[model samples]
Structures are given as structure tokens and as C-alpha cells.
Target chain A: MANKHYAMVIDLNTCVGCNACMAACAMENQTPVWKNSWRTYVHDLEIDPGTDHQVRRRFFPRLCNHCDNPPCMSVCPTGATHKLDNGIVLVDDELCMGCRACSMACPYDARFDVSYNDVEQGKEFYGELHHRTRPGVDKCSFCAHRVMKGLKPACVETCVGSARLFGDLNDPDDKVAKLVKTGVAKPLMAHLGTRPNVYYISEIERAR
Target chain B: MEGMFYSTQNVWTWWIAIYLFLGGLGAAAVVVSCLTNMYIKTHKELVLWGNISAFVMLSVGSLFLFVHLLDHLAVIHVLNPFGLLTKPDAWIMWGTQFIVWMMVFSMIYTLPYMLETPFWRDMPLVGTILGWFGWLGKLSLSFHKVVGWLAIINGVGTVLYTGLLLQSFPAVALWHNPGVPLLFIISAFSTAMAFLLLVLHLAIKREEDHDIKVLYERTDVILISIELLIIFVFFHFTTYGLESARHTADILWNDMGWIVGFIGFGLIVPFLIEFRGVTKGWNSATPVVLAAILVLCGGYLLRHYFMYAGSYERPYPAINSIHSQSNYNLLIE
Candidate 1:
């Protein structure tokens, strides 16, 4: 368990822009749905708009990268945002002072503040059994709770076309490891030096 | 496509800006007053008011910081000694430590002076409380220079912490500049001088301390000059440097508050007024007071605009380029 390293591989070729992951994440994490925020979401990118060339739309899914060198963790005053042994970054609600310094430091726009009002509304919107009990900065935890139970993240579990893949990167036999080893799957903004665990397989390679 | 993916950071707002301004102002005031007392002349009134103002400003700024927190009670976690020990690189943790120590040291430094003042010594309940701390005041007076030096060091720390807090956020292109701390330090001192000038002219009405007043005006002129130059460097660096920084410059350039309020009214006018006063003989209090007010306003505006102009780099530009070019090639193929 100490050697375990979790990672995700997202294939743009297989994703259908169905947004099943967003819904699954909202239902699972009880995010501020009324505010249109999510732990994971898909962006419909239009390439070469208003040009002579044919315009094309691609679905780009995004989430917290859970970087090895998380800037959010370094900037957090309360030591609330921390990395687990398995490489998943998580926030301790009781420790977070809600300063949003993590949100300011994150390059991927991964974090959002959960205010007192959001928590009060959440009790009604998500019922009393909601996992979020206190207000703090919130982000995708790679569904660490479920992952600890030997289950995939909600978004990966409910992906419409099986485009999302999650596995331990430390295991050479895992599909995520192979995809990363082959260089077919690449992390976004690699030059930023965050060393993100989430990798993306480009749609252009799929078309080729 | 250039501006399509750019996002302005919205987490921090005016509250954080106010906290930064007040914290810097307070710390700078303490530094100036302490140095003046040690080197030039020992003015008890100056020391007393300076320490009191610093304590009050820092307290009010901390109040704003508390208001900005989403979970107010969770702020206690920031005081965990373990977190402070472990997170040495965290500017916020260092800032909290600096601020707390500064408040404590400033209060102790002010105690001896407070006990000496008849207004405080004769007060009913407060006088009794002051009497309780009279022994502590004697102890502080015995080691007055040590307490003053400690307060000065922490004051400098608090001032630098204000800028370091923003500089630690590498994601915000506007705040990530090396010039940020320099600019903030210079502005903090200049505004501190202006604050003292206002107090000297209006509150203390110390016309006899002409030498000290001249010293403040001279120091402020130099500080303001350096600050204006650093601002130029800031604009040049941000404009020609990173893409996100260039975008930040564009936003800041168009901001009237940054251009007119901060540059025109805040820095330049005050500089000219002080420059003329320093060069010529004694002038009216009206212009001096007006210039001080402008400088203070300008200091707050600088922080406000810097906070609002924080822009994140566009998401994965290299990836987007590859995606578009590769897609176009595939369509052609």
C-alpha cells in the first residue's frame, strides 16, 4: 500500500461529450450544483472557428491533476491540502481556514471555495447524509473514499464510452502505466513542472 | 483563440487587498518610527502614537482577513505550532507568525510610554490596569532598546510578508514578478511617511520638530521616486514577459484606478508636492495634508488593482496548438 501510486488516463477518442462523468461526480461528491460547479467536467472545444478550413469540436475532460509537486499544498497556510501515500491529494475540512490561497496557486483551476451558505444549501439539496459537513476549499479527491474501498472514482466508473481509465501507476501491468510508458498518454501543461498524474490521449492520434 | 481560454482569478478580492495594504502600512509605520527614535531623536509622543497606530492597523487588517475566511473558526488551525514548524516555505504561515509577534512586541514596546502618559495613568479602570502592568513597563524600559529592535525586525517581517504572500502564488502571472516585493516595500515606507506626516501636522501639531518633519519629507521623496521607477520596471517586465503577464498588463493599463488614481493622483502629485516643499522654504499645511491623503489612497489602490488583475495562464497552449494543427492535417489527409 505504501508503494501504490494512483493515476488516470483519459482517451479523447472514446469520449462522446455525453457529460455522464459530470453528473456522476455531482451526485457522488455533492458539489454545489446550484452554482454550476463540479469536481470534473467536459469542455466542448471548437478548433479553427470562422476559418476556411472545416471547424471541428472536441470534448476535453478536466479534473484536479493531483500533481506530485502541488503548488496548492505549498501555499496552504493550514497544511490542510496534503498528498496521501498513494499520490492522491486530499483536503482536511477541519484544517482548512478557507483562505482560498490553494485556489490562487493551482494552475489548473481545480479548486473552489465551499462557503457557509453553500453548506447550508447543500444540506437541503443533498440531504443530511451528504459527505460535505463543513465549509472549506473543495476539489476532486480522485474519489479517495471510494478508491480506499477498492472502487474506481465516480467519474471514471460512469464514463459513457469507457474513455476514463484509473489504476495504480506503480503496477507495471496496469493499463494506465502502459499508456503512460508508451508515451501515447501525456499530461497537460507538463512544462509547468506540476508532474500531474492525470494523462490525456489526444483525439488527433485516434484519427490517425 | 488567443484570449479564449484566459481566466481571471476570483478567489481573492478587496478584503485581501485591504488586509495587505493595512498590514504593510502598519509594519512600515513601526519601522520608520523605531528607526527615527533610535538614530535621530527620542520623541515619546511619536513612539507612542506610532506603536498604537501599528497595533490598531494590524488588528483591523487581521479582522478583514478573518472576514475573508469562509470558515472563520477554522482559522485556529493556522495557529498550530506544528504547521508553522513544518511549513517554512508557506508565506501565509510565516505571515501569521510575523503579524502575531509584531502585535505582541508593539504592545510591549508601547507599554512604558503608555504608563508615562498622565492621560493613561489617571484613567479609572484603565489606570488600574496600567498600574498592574507598571512593573512590566519598568522591565520593558530597562531593556527598551532590545524591545524596540525586536519590534522593528518583526515590523520589517510583516511588511515583507505582505508582498511575499502574493509572490508565493506562481499561478497568478501579475503577482509572480520579482519586482512585487520591492515595489510593495517601497510603497509601504512612502505611505508610512505620509501617514506620519498627517499625524504630525493634524494630531500632534508638532511645529517644533521641524528637523524630523524635514527628514520624513526627504525620505518619502526618495522612496516615492524609487517606487515610480519600480512601477515602470513592473509594467515593462509584465508587458514583454509571459503571455499571461502581458494580458495582466493589458488589463491594468486600461484600469483607470491604476493609471489615474494610483499614478497620476497617488504617486506623481505627492512626489511633486513633497519635492517642491523640500526644495523651497516652509509651505502651507493644506498642500502637505492633501498630498499625504493622496499617497495613502494610492497605496490602497495599488493593492486593490494588483489583486483584481491576477490572471492565470491559458490552459495548455502547446497542447491546444498541437491538437488544432494535427486535426487540420488529418482533415487535409
Candidate 2:
């Protein structure tokens, strides 16, 4: 099979910051309920100068960018964090020594701590995945399991505003590839040279 | 661009700082011990102390790192040699392998001398087991210069690795500077000398060897001065380079607790006292002990402050999530 380059595009203009996607991701991935789960997050871009809740606010959804040149993968001492043939970054929890070096290397701060042994709760939610059974570094897998089954990520499927889109960028006819070719979708911190797969499309001017 | 999004709290804590400090101390001890043994004929006592110190400090340092892991039992994963050969960019893998080799070499270098001691002589079984490899130590002595040189090279790698560990973290501006390795290497040697001085005075009661004592004291004074100068450059470069680095610089500059306690009292005072003591030909234990203690504490605190100074660039700072630190007042405008 040809290699796939999966990517996600979050439409900032449509996102309500309701965190419905976050909930869906947690349920689907069996991520930690603790405050620092890494599956996905919503950042409210406070661009407005007024007190009005209805105006000038942009909800920016963030997850592991799963970069083409992931620094996190580069720094992993044990090769626990790796990029699959499909372009999704993954952690081999069994191989992870809980060094936290990869977590420090991530520019987006997308990685989370799951090195504790008491994390049976996430395992109970996820059942048995050979790599993710034990505690180690945690981050978004781009929902590789679902994507492999010809389905969208839980977050993309459940987005109320249809704000999230996921598809194989390798397919030139894919919606994500066409949207990216349009030049409106911007990857966060593009200058960092990670070549993040996650992109955002925004109508509002970014704050200086 | 600054103060947009307060940084999410990082997971590394004081344990990591202490581990870095100890790793440096142990590396310096090993290097200095090997150098002294090779070059100076009359410093057998100093070499012995350095060897023992290197072994103890490095072992304890590795223990701290092992304990820092989220799952303490899974440490064997780090021992896999596949990571080292396959991943050249993995400094942690390099570090683990280096330290393991360092420990082995340190034990090899120290065993012959240890056998000569009354404790080892009393246990003849140790001699019986060690007799098989006794030729290695004898061979080591024949090529003592070469062995010592190898130790020095590995020691330097270990020290630089501690700094490189932090430098690889490109996100945290405070930890990503090239100056980190240089500063850490200098501090490691200084603290290692201080550690030796304390042991010489307290454990061996070696007040007779004024020449060696004065040499260490003079060297530490100079190291402390170099440390201050490097710190100045570290701050100057960061403050002018990028906004995130400037944010880290601001945090460092405003931190009166670190400045007054660590740099001022712990570092500068020790330098002044040791310098004054060395120049005046004053040979009191009080001044030496005080300076040594200060240098050791100051080195540890420098690592502590570096961890606290880590800050991330908040490009989209408006999202006030529960993960955000509460102390940063949100921009009202």
C-alpha cells in the first residue's frame, strides 16, 4: 500500500470552543480525565478588546501536530515515540522509560505525562492495545485506529460546527489537500521547522 | 507577543535539578582524579579521594534519575542498547551508556588501591575474585596515561551531556542556550574541587599538604569568576535574541531570591573568601570549609533556578484553560 500523510485542519471561524470535540476524543481514546490529557485542547484566542462574549473571540483547537520532522520523536531516548508510515506520531508506552525528554522537546507542548503506574483507568477505557497498555508519554495518535478503518477521528465526527476535518494529504483529491492547497490553512509556528501536519483556517486577523 | 498565554506548568521539578548537579559533580571528580594521577606524582591521596567521590556521587546521581521515572520498575527499558546504536540524536541514550561505562572504569581504576587498604585486605575472598582481573589493573597502570586520558574524555562528554540535555529542549528558551554546556562544565569542575577540599579537610584532616590545598583553593576562586562572566553572557545573549528568550531573561533578572541567595551569598561570597584566603597565605580550616560548602550549594541552586525560569511562547495566549497557571493575570484589553 502507498504511504499516507494524514492531516487535520481546524476551522477557527466555525469553532465555538464548546469542547465537544475534546469530550468525544476523551471518550474515544480513553484519555486521562486529569487536567493535562493530550488528545486535544481548545485555546480561546482572545483578540477582542471588549467585554462582550459574543464578539471577536476565536477558539483554536490544538493537538499533537504529528510533524513531518517531529522533534519529540528525534529526542526520544528509547525510540518510544515514532512516526508511522501513515504520518501519525505514536508512543510505545512499553518502551517509554518515563524520561520526559520527548515532552520537553515538543514545541507545541502537546505531550502529556502518563508515566504513573496507577493509570489503569485509561487502560480500562481503551482495553488492550499492545503499545499503550502501560504508563508512558501520552499524545494524540491522530486517531490512527479509526482512520485505518476508513472512518474519521472521533473529534472530527462529533464537531458540532463541522470545524474539524481529517483526511490523507497524500491523496491529491482529498478535501484536506484541496483546502491546504488553497493557501488559507496555516500551520502554527511554521518557522519552527517541524512542518506540523495540523493546520488552522481563520477568518479573524491574528493578534500581534 | 509576551504574556499572551501563561505557560502550562511543566512536569520537571527539583529532583531533576539535583540529578543534573550531581551528574556534573561526579563527572568532574572522575576527570580531575585521572588528571591528577597522570600529571602529579605526590597527589596519590587526592586521586584516591576523587576516585571514591566519583563512584559514590555517580551512583547516587543515577539512583535519583531512576527514582524520577514515573514507573520506577521500568528502568530496564533504558538499558536496551538498540536505542544507542540506532538513534544518534538521543542524548539520553548516550548519557546512560556513558555513565554505565564511567562507573565500570571508575571501579577498575579504584580497585587496586582499595585492595591495598586495611578493609579490603581483611576480606581475602575479595582478593581471590579480583586476582583473575588483577592483570587489568596492572595493565591499566602500565598504560596509566592512556587510561587517564580516556577517563578525561568520557568525563568531559558526561558533563557536556548534562547541559546538552537541557539545550535540546528548544521550546524552553532558558534551557536551550549553548551557554548551558559551557556554564555547566565550568561549574562542575569548581564544585568538584570544592567537594575534594571539604573531604580533604574533614575526612583526611590533611592540613599538612598546604601546596595541594592552595592549588585547589586558587583554582576554585578562578572558576567562580569565570562562572559569573559566563552567566553575564548567557543573560545578554538570551535577552537580545528572541521574545521568548527575553521573557525567560526577564524572569531570571527579576528573581531576587535566586540572585541574592544563590549567586550573591553562595557563589560570590565563596569566591571572595577563597581568593582572600589564598592571597594572604592564611591556612585556616574555617575559610576553606565555608567556601567549599557555599560552592556546592550554589551549584545546586543554579540548576534549581534554571528549571524555574523555563517559559513557553504563547502565540495564541487568549485561551484560559484550567491547565494555565493562575498567577498570570489575563490581559484585560
Top model number, DockQ? 2
Winning candidate number (lDDT): 1
Error of 1 at B172 (Å): 1.5
In candidate 2, position B231 carries an lDDT of: 87
lDDT of the candidates, in the order given: 0.84, 0.77
Q: The CA-based lDDT of model 2 is what?
A: 0.77
Per-residue lDDT of model 1, residues B1-333, tens digit only: 252355565446788888999999999999888888878898888888888898899999999988888899988876665667878778989888888888888778889889989988998998899999989999988898898889899899989999988888777678876789999999999999999998888888877888888889899899999999999998898788787777678778877889999999999999999998899945578888888999999999999989877766644321210013332232223
Worst 10 residues of 2 chain A by lDDT: A124-133
TM-score of each: 0.92, 0.89
How is the predicted docking of candidate 2 categorized under the CAPRI scheme? acceptable
Tell me how far candidate 1 lies from the true structure as C-alpha RMSD in angstroms. Answer: 5.2
Q: Report the CAPRI category for model 1.
A: acceptable
> Which sections of candidate 2 miss by over 4 Å?
A34-36, A44-46, A50-55, A115-118, A123-132, A205-208, B123-139, B316-333
How big is the positional error of residue B310 in model 2, measured in Å on the Cα after superposition?
Answer: 0.7
lDDT (10s digit) by residue, model 1, range A1-208: 4479999999988899999999999999899978767788788777655556787777888889999999899999988999998999999998898888888888887777788899999999988777777898899999999999999999999998999999988899999999999889999777677899999998665666
